[model samples]
Target: MFDIKSFFKREVEKKLIDVDDYIFMPERVEMELEGGLLNCVLNSDGRVDIFYSKEGVTEVSSASRKHPFTSFETELNHGVYDDVIDDLIKEVSKIIDGSSKYFRRNKVLPSTAALPSKPPTDL
Candidate 1:
């Protein structure tokens, strides 16, 4: 199992405004942190998001037809999902070693608030 709690700490609320700069993966997408639901914005790579929400996380208010890839896959494995919200998120999610459970049981890719620059090399 992945330490989702810490994962959130490291990525979800890292104060990273322009996540695109931190991650340079081809599929990484930018992210927007909201109440609970991490909405995935449409991009050339993919239009979806991957996240683990707290119990009271936000929900999708507007009704829709197809469940985005994130929603669909999330239904299967609650731990992780994928969407193309921005360039950064898309890129981060693709890396197998990006995180502890990157592609296995706990692989996930979520965005967070922007932070001051600390040099990509530092990260």
Candidate 2:
């Protein structure tokens, strides 16, 4: 018997771990770019949202569902569910890669804020 709830839980956890690898910060991972700021978050609903902020406002946003596995029928095939999760992982990987690259190119360090300048030597 296929345990849909257990399968979903396992797949979601796996995907979250994969996503966390790209996120160097807590819930909100952010980067600064010439265009603006890029932010991503793993939502409670098992969806990931990417936002682009310019001039202190979000200009663009995109979302992807973590559970790509599932069927309309009450009963689902185990193999099919596995395949869906695989696909979901691949799609999320691309998003993570893209976000990481953007941060790298922009020279933004996640989970870090610029520190104050050193005081004068004379002080």
* Best by the TM-score measure: 2
Error of 2 at 76 (Å): 30
Candidate 1 local lDDT, residue 4? 83
lDDT per residue for candidate 2 within 6-101, as digits (tens), equals 999999788765633442222455656445565555454535556555544443343543333332121122332334434444454456445543
Candidate 2, residue 86: Cα displacement in angstroms equals 24
lDDT of model 1 at residue 33? Answer: 48
lDDT of each structure? 0.38, 0.48
TM-score of 2: 0.29
Per-residue lDDT of candidate 1, residues 1-123 (tens digit): 889889888885555533333422223222344322354333333333344232333232221213232433343235333232233333334442244533555555578989868757865
Please report the candidate that would top lDDT against the real structure: 2
Candidate 1 wrong stretches, greater than 4 Å: 1-35, 55-123
Error of 2 at 63 (Å): 1.9
Query: When superposed on Cα atoms, how far off is each prediction in RMSD?
Result: 25.1, 17.1
Ten residues in a row with the worst lDDT in model 1? 58-67
